[model samples]
Target: MNSHEGRPAGLRERTRRAVQAEIVATAMRLFLEHGFEATTMEQIANDVGISRRSLFRYFGTKEDIVLGDHAEHGLALRAALEARPADESPWEALRAALKSLFESLPYAPEEFIKITTMLHASPSLRARQLEKRQQWAELLMPDIAARLGEATDPMTRLRAHALVACALACSEAATDAWVHSNGTIDMERAYDEAVAAVRG
Candidate 1:
């Protein structure tokens, strides 16, 4: 038998995921209490009862800790877009994919608002947020190019980038409206209206 035969597959992945979640949770709490600039990796590691080196193994920087969940969201958004029915128009598929991705958020709307507020208040975080959106656009490009039946054309690539940019803009606008309303506005409705406006 092999040296490691019969072990459960993905056990290492599961453990890594668990540790990452713990680090994120701890870092978020510290950031909320002390502000992002004031928080340190050492403090986060100490709070989570791990060494700074161990923390670095999971995240490369403080910004990564703050925006870690966003990376997952980008991946999920790409998957949602890719899984959309081929018969659906690009605009419709984009709208449905955004809605589905938003609905799958593990946190409540209030928590999202808090995170948004934090991001807006921090220049570094806002930069990271834009970077994440750009990454999403990159992720969506190939799928969009295929969906539009112009997989190898330069115009198709530009169009795909424009569509993803528009979607990201709509999402930002909806988030701004929600924040301005103090969470009284329904996020789903706001996002839907924003997307529809873009489609028109």
Candidate 2:
């Protein structure tokens, strides 16, 4: 049984969140200033006023800094999908999750544009991010398979994969559109449009 399940969660959870947020903040600053490849773990550690070993306690590698919370994002999406009305279609549930994500970000369009730029500018990071997305797909696949039950044959898995791929592709397209429009367009709208196109 999870300790957090029963009690009102306490200081440890708060501390963990604050520490993780600080790590991401510090790492993002370094990444933007020096470029991802040029930034070193030692520099990040020094900048954060910690030993290299200590930094590793928070993040094992530089790539991990960028992709660390990606798994958590998947989990959140799953939770969001689960919360949608039981009668909701999978695509509809996924659309709700996308909307929730777009709404949850605190950054301005310019900031998000820069993040997308940085991710693409670094080849290794891009590859790593893609790999992470694939890993997320695998994590999600089982749930989708179970949802489809006996109907979830190989062809069903293929369709489910395609749906997941389509969602991702829409997200990327929306980001590109957001960047190109210079904060003029609504990202949520772009995402909605992409999903609509894919569903159609």
lDDT of each: 0.86, 0.78
Residue-wise lDDT of candidate 1 within 77-136, one digit each (tens)?
989998998888877787788888888987777787787788899999999889988988
User: Candidate 2's C-alpha lDDT?
Assistant: 0.78
lDDT per residue for candidate 2 within 149-191, as digits (tens), equals 5435887788777777787788878878888787789878898
lDDT (C-alpha) at residue 37 in model 2? 88
Q: Residue 127 lDDT in model 1?
A: 96
Worst 10 residues of 1 by lDDT: 1-10
Show model 1 residue runs off by greater than 4 Å.
3-10, 196-200
- The RMSD (Cα, Å) of candidate 2 is 4.0
